[model samples]
Structures are given as structure tokens and as C-alpha cells.
Target: MAVQEHLIESQDRAAMIDPFVQLAFLNDAIDDLTAANLDLLDAEWFARYARSVDELTARLDAISIEARHRGHDRHCGFFSTKAWIKHHVQLTGSDAHGRIQTMRMFDLLPTWAAAARSGEVGVAQTRLMARVAANPRVHVGLLKCVESLLVDAIVLPYDEFERRIRDFQRSADQTGAETQARLNHAARDAMMRQKADGSWILWATFGSLQGAQVNEVLAHFIQAEWETDWAEARNRCGDDATLSDLQRSEPQRRADAAAAVFLAAASAPGDRRAPLPTLNIVIDDTTAEVIVSGGRLDAARYNKMICHTQNGDPIDCSEAAAIALWGHIRRVVRDASGVVIDMGRRSRLFTGAARQAVLLLSDRCLWPGCDRPNRNCEADHSLGWKAHGNTVPWNGGTMCRAHNRLKETGNFSARRQANGSWTIHDNDGEPIG
Candidate 1:
């Protein structure tokens, strides 16, 4: 019986080796799957379908790589593999180029390719890995840690996984990262053009750090516009007001807010010193020493460093060092676990310096699925004041007015974790993702 089963398996494998057989099997499978009633499918079925699709995509990518290796494009009268793919696959130019690039990256990183083929990682995660692998300065070093990064890709959210990869690149090639930052800064430009219609077009480019600053200021102005719209809607329609009742569309509001920003800047008083925007830049001790002394650090030491904006956007350590020389810097110390060890004030309400510290630390509201910016959020006690929570930075969390009110009603709660992050729980004490 074992010999018969082995013979059958070998026969099946050999049959699949023929391209026509594979195509017939795929066509039949897709037709059967698509014939199913979509309303009858369960969550588990959808998940399994997605995984199968990803595995098939990986296999197709592998075939594309093999075709490129065999010079099939040249044989087909095409100059480049990308051009042939664009034509044959009916994909956009950019999509075809991206697909070709990703396939090439898979040839270089076998572990990632294996994981992709097995459906252990999805296409989005693999695309991010391909992007990192394309960087020459970090490509060789990144290959050494493919397994570890694969774990992150499988377990973490896409955004966090992207951050981890970027952090690795920065640590592996700090000089290259710094040079790129300098190039971006040098290339920054802004232009205003008047069209035939009486309206004007504004365009600008900024490096990561400077763009973050611009984004921060724009967020405040946008929030102000939102507040006005919300107030007007509530006043007109009371609690029945919906998003459609808003006075302006989102794009219109953003354009108005941009104009408001320019008007505010132009009208500012020249005699008095305007308050500069506060940007939180986190750096560890060793990296700070290296940046301050203009010295080089080993990759291991660089890996230990933490240098990024408050919103987790990594910037060049050298740029942070230069800013520290002329900017008013506030030192907030944290312990090994990233819990703030210093800077606490005694008060019932989160006020003044304490409030500023809370805003500086928080990028958005603590409530799950809430992306209300910290500037528009109110600082609240995770352990309520009535419950004897201390009025310290560690005890406080940021939440929007609506969510804060909901928490106050005792249907929800928040906890400040050891790493200075917040976890919100439902009325049943289940943690919300």
C-alpha cells in the first residue's frame, strides 16, 4: 500500500510539472471557488482563501523569475522583462516594474521567498522586505536577519513591521541614512503657480523631519476647521447631525486650513518672539554621545540606539545633534523599560507642563480605533483621580473628548503599560486591539 501511495504522489507531481496541466487545474479550481455563494462563506473560509491566493501569487512570482533567468523576454522580442510583463500581464507600468523588482528581490533572499511560497507571510509584508533588500547599503546585512524579520512580518502589524525594517536599515548604515537625509534637505523646494482660472496651486517638498514639523502644524489648523464644522453641524441638526451635514468637504477644509496657516503666519507680530513648535526627538545615551562627539559607533552599538520623532518616524542622528546645538532642549529621562522616570508634577488636573509632556509623548488618542491627534485630545487619568490615581505623566493618557466621556461613564477603561503605551478595555474587561 505504501509503494502504491508513493507511486501516485510521484505521478501527481509529474503531471503538475506540465504547464498546461497546471493551468487546467488552476482554471477549474478558480471556477469552482467562484461559483460558491459569497453570502454563505464564513470568516475562516475567507481567511483560508486569502492564504491560498497568496501562496499561488508567490508561485507565480517564482515562475516570473525563472522566465527572466531563461531570457524568455528577449526570445519574445521584448527588450526588458518588465516591459514584457507589462504587456503580457496587462498591468500598469509602475505595477509591472514593482512586480519585477519584487521577484528579483526574492531571488536574493531565499528565506523570505520560502516563507512567501508557504503563505507564512503576505504580499504586503514581502513587498516591504523587498524594499529593504533593494537598498545596497543594508542588503547584505539584512539577509543575515531574514528569519528574525520574517517573524516580525508574520506577527506584527504592517506599520510596526515597516518601522522595524527601517530601524534595522538605519542601524546597519547610519552614514548612508545621514547622507540621504542631507540630500533630501538640499532638494527641498516650494512653488506657487497661478493658473488661468484665478486660483493658485501650491507645491512643496520637505525631508522627513521637516515634513513632520509641517504635518504637525497642519494638523492643528485642520483640527480647528473640523471643530468649527462640528459645532455648526451640532447647532443646526442637534444630536442627529451626521458627517454628511458638515459645512465643507474634507479636501475643501484642508485647502481652507492651508490658507489659514499662511494668513496666520503673515499676520504674526514681528516685535515679539513667537513660540517655536515643540518636536520630540528621542535618542539613547550611546547614540547621543557618538552624535555629539562626531565619532563613529559600531553596528552593534548603533542597533541599541533610539532616534526618531514622537510619531515613530526615524530621522538622522546627526540632524538631531545639530538641532540640539541651537534649540531649547528638554531632557526627559526614561528607564530601561521606556517608562518615564523623571518629570512629574503634583496636580488633580493634567495642566501646564504636565499636559505638554503628555501631548509630547502621545501621538494620538488611547482609545482603540481612534486616530484623533494628541493636539486635539484631552489628557485623562488612566486610573481615575477619584480612584486615587496620581497626577503624574505615567498615570495620564490622552483621549478625545467623546472617548474620554465614554471612559468617564465606566463602560470603558485604560491602563498605562510599562512601556508608556496605553491599552483600552471594554466594559467586560476584554482588551481592545
Candidate 2:
């Protein structure tokens, strides 16, 4: 029966062979095939080998330094360090580094390393074993136990492999959340690869909230000017109060108040864009404050705040006149019609010279973990716009289109309080509360 089994597994003599692959496998398997015994290399003996390896590595490094002594001119680019190793060392990039690290790991752990080296399993599996064996800190910390539990992972059935990993993590007190976070951080890669050619469009689905947060932060940093995006706003809020601090500084604080009054005076809450009007508010040395109502205010309830001018004098008026004036202020408060607004279109509009006011209200993106500019985001109705959301920037916010979709579709939601701030939530109908 044994003879029959051997004959059944024997290769066909007529089959073609690749000398390169055969040599590669032999070389790859040698370390694993070697047993760990004092006779082979005790501490003293291995010390000599270590010295030799170090000297050889130093010589190789010197060669690299000499080659780059001068600024690179591409004259000998093909003869660079990698090319030299591939040609003379006869090793691929992946193989070379892996071999070096694996050998180091093996030498550092004799018994466990030798078992892995001696074909207890294949290269990938053995490599994992070597990793667990060599790291004393991790070994002591229980991560090493994963190796014994997941031995021969390369050959293990998928179900078995999964079971072992879970078993190992659970028994070892390792949490999936922690493992996933590490993987994401280590492997995270994002780039606007084609944007170097100058195109203003990008599209990709974010697989996690972490990814979306990263994108938000990056968007603000990439802009040519300080954009009122959620990311920038968050950055501003940290350690420094950002725009709030800047606008409220001793030199600029009064203007902040004036801007608020101007915003409040100009905001027409109901039928938002009733009539577009421009008014500049100024109060020198005295404290000034304004509030721009983004949505329709129940005027009968909150009429006292807006009807007052910069001097704090109330404008006594007919309900009809107040209603008309309210609409005009709304349009002028946010000139963009809640669409494409280039504050740069009239630099003065954003500049202190024009002394124009932005809708001074909630300042940041409502998205959790998102500190972005309100300006860059879409003016989304916390409630659906079609469902009675007025087209006023006061009722609006600057949110990226991405968050806008999430808000609109109920994947995310926000509710602005009567006090003009907001609370946000994620897709599961769970408030980020």
C-alpha cells in the first residue's frame, strides 16, 4: 500500500521543470530545515557570524552612500542599490528583506525558531511562527500564543483558520476592535493620484467612519486658502478656539458683534429670500452682538431680536413690513442661494474691509469626529429641505456633499436646538449623543 501511494504521487518524468523555481524553493526551505542545537551554533559561535554579517552590511551601506555622493542625475539610475542586489545577491525585493528579518528572528529564538525552520509547515506559516517566537515582549504578552493556535495557517482550512484566530484573540484577551484599528492605521493609504494634472473631481466610497474623518481633515489642509470646511474648523477649535477666537479677539471682537447684528438685521427667516438687502453694522469700542436666523422664525414668538438696529433701537413696524424686510435680509445674509459661493468672488465680502457678515451661528460640521468648515459643506436642512427646510444659509450649513447625502438619506441626521447649535447622529438611527 505504501509503494502504491508513492507511485501514485510520483511526478511524470516527461514534465517540464523550472530550474529557477526549484533553486528558489531549496533556498527558501533551508532555514526551516535546519535544527536548533548547541552543536550547530552556541552563543560564542553565533557571535562570530553576527560580527561578520554586521561588517558585510556596513560595507553594502557604504557602497550606497558613495553612489549617492553626488546629486542623482539618472545617469546610472538602473545601476542603483536595488538593481545591484537583484543582480548580484540573486534575491527579489520581498525575499531579501523577509529573509534578513526571518533569519534575525530565528537566531533570537532557538527551539521555537528551529521547529518553524525544519518544515513543520510552509514558508508563510513559518514566518508567522518566527514573528511570534522572536518578539519576547509580545510572546510574554500573549500574542505569541496565536502561532500555536494557528499553526500551518497556510494549509489550514479557511473555517479552521478563522476559528483559531478568533480563539487565540479571545483567549489571549485581544479585542477585534483593537486589532482592526491597528490594521487600518498601518495600512492606511490615500492619495489624489491623478490630481497632480489638475482636475477638481474625486469619487470613492469610504469603508469606515475613520476613513471619512481622515478625508475631512485632508480636504481642509489641501485648499489654497483658509476654507470654511468642517476639518479646518475642527483644527481651529483645538488648543485654539480657531475662528471663534480670531473673530472675537480684542481688535476684531466688536466687528464680530457688528457682523452678528448685520446678519440678524439682514436675515429674513420666513420665505427666506424675501428681498435682498445689504446693511453694514458698526459699533466702535462698545460690545455688539447679532444673530442671523437661518430658518423661518415664528415671528410672533421671536420678533424682538431682529427688528432692532445696530444702535440697539427697536424698529417699530407693521407686521407686513417686518415680513417683507425679513425676506430681503435672508437672501443677503447668505448671498449664494445656498449654492456655489465663491467668497473670493468679492474678496471684500469675506475680507474685513467689506465688513460683511457671514451667518454667525453654529460654526462647525455636525458630523461626529469631523471638525470641518461650515462654508465648504452643503447647506443641508436638518429636516429634509423639501419637507419645509427654507433656503436660507442661517437654516443652512456648510457641509461637504458626502455628509449632505448621508444627512438627506437618513444615514445621518442632525437637529438644531432652539439655541442655534446642533446634535448629530449616524445611520443606525442612533444619535451620536
> What's the C-alpha lDDT at position 69 in model 2?
22
Tell how far residue 395 is off in model 1, in angstroms: 3.4
Candidate 2 ranges with C-alpha deviation above 4 Å: 1-88, 92-94, 108-118, 131-136, 141-147, 150-155, 158-433
Write down the worst ten-residue block by lDDT for model 2.
282-291
**How well is each residue in 1-433 modelled by candidate 1, as lDDT tens digits?**
9999999999998876978877799889889877877667687787677767767776665555445434546866888877887787788998777777787788888888887777678778887777777778777567676777888798766666776677777767878888999999999999999999998999999987787678768877988999999999999999889899998999999999999999998899888784764677766667777778978644543334577666556767787777766674333333345445334445788887777666656667878778776777998888888788877777878898889988878778899877565788989998866
| lDDT by residue (tens digit), candidate 2, 1-433 | 9988776566543255665786588567655545435368876677766655444343333222223222223376644444554455677886544544555555554543444434343444444544444434334433334344434354454333443333333223223323454565466554434566675333434322334333333443343233333345566676434455442333343334434443555674766453333321211111111112222222122211222222122222122123334443222222112222333322312333221232233234566556455434444555645556544434444455567666767667777666555667767666663
TM-scores, in order shown?
0.82, 0.23
Q: Number of the top candidate by TM-score?
A: 1
Candidate 1: residue 397 lDDT (0-100): 80
Per-model CA lDDT versus the true structure: 0.75, 0.41
